[model samples]
Target: MGTMFYGDDSTALHFEDRALAHLKVVIATKLRRGESFTISWVHGPGEQRGRSTVWISPSIPLRFVFDDPEPTTLNPRYLDQLATSANSSGGIQLIDEDPVP
Candidate 1:
């Protein structure tokens, strides 16, 4: 399973993998371009949703850190699927010849 986050009506962001590679890509791009946006996720019980303003910037290294967590392996195939979807939605460009990257 994966998580999907939305920003207004035009922007939709999907974050999967414990590494959060795709999410970082999108956030970095926006922040590098001086754009700010919101991302919401469902956390805790009762289906409560929490939203946060993501501040993206090129200075932020591509890394994942959580207060307390166990490492989760990421499937390359799943990352490929996410890259494809992002490409289709104009979030990112499709890498050369590859269906998704």
Candidate 2:
């Protein structure tokens, strides 16, 4: 599994390659259509807390698959929130976000 983390001196954004790729595609498509989304993730030793968002454009294509058993549903409004958060944070990057074993 691979992970990436993006943040500054205060907070951080963490995500997995597979899930991120899927999210990237969704966000990119929305951006292409002049839309936005709110993507977020949490950061912690366990799966309890740690989340962040990123504003992505359609120009960016994600190349990974979500590793969870069940798939996540896509929501336009939710995506919008993610975009908003990403923009507010002065842009987001992969920060400690990785894949699982």
Candidate 1: what lDDT?
0.43
| lDDT per residue as tens, model 2, 1-101 | 33333233233333554446545654555566865444545554656665655544444443333446555554455455445545554443333323332
Kindly report which residue stretches of model 1 are placed more than 4 angstroms away from their true locations once superposed.
1-16, 44-63, 66-101
Candidate 2 whole-model C-alpha lDDT, 0 to 1? 0.47
Candidate 2 similarity to native, TM-score? 0.36
**TM-score, per-candidate, Cα-based:** 0.33, 0.36
Candidate 2 RMSD to the real structure: 9.4
lDDT of each: 0.43, 0.47
The model with the greatest lDDT is 2
lDDT of 1 by residue, 1-101 (tens): 23333334334333444435445455555666765444334343443476333433345333443333655554566556444544353333322222334
Candidate 1 has a TM-score of 0.33
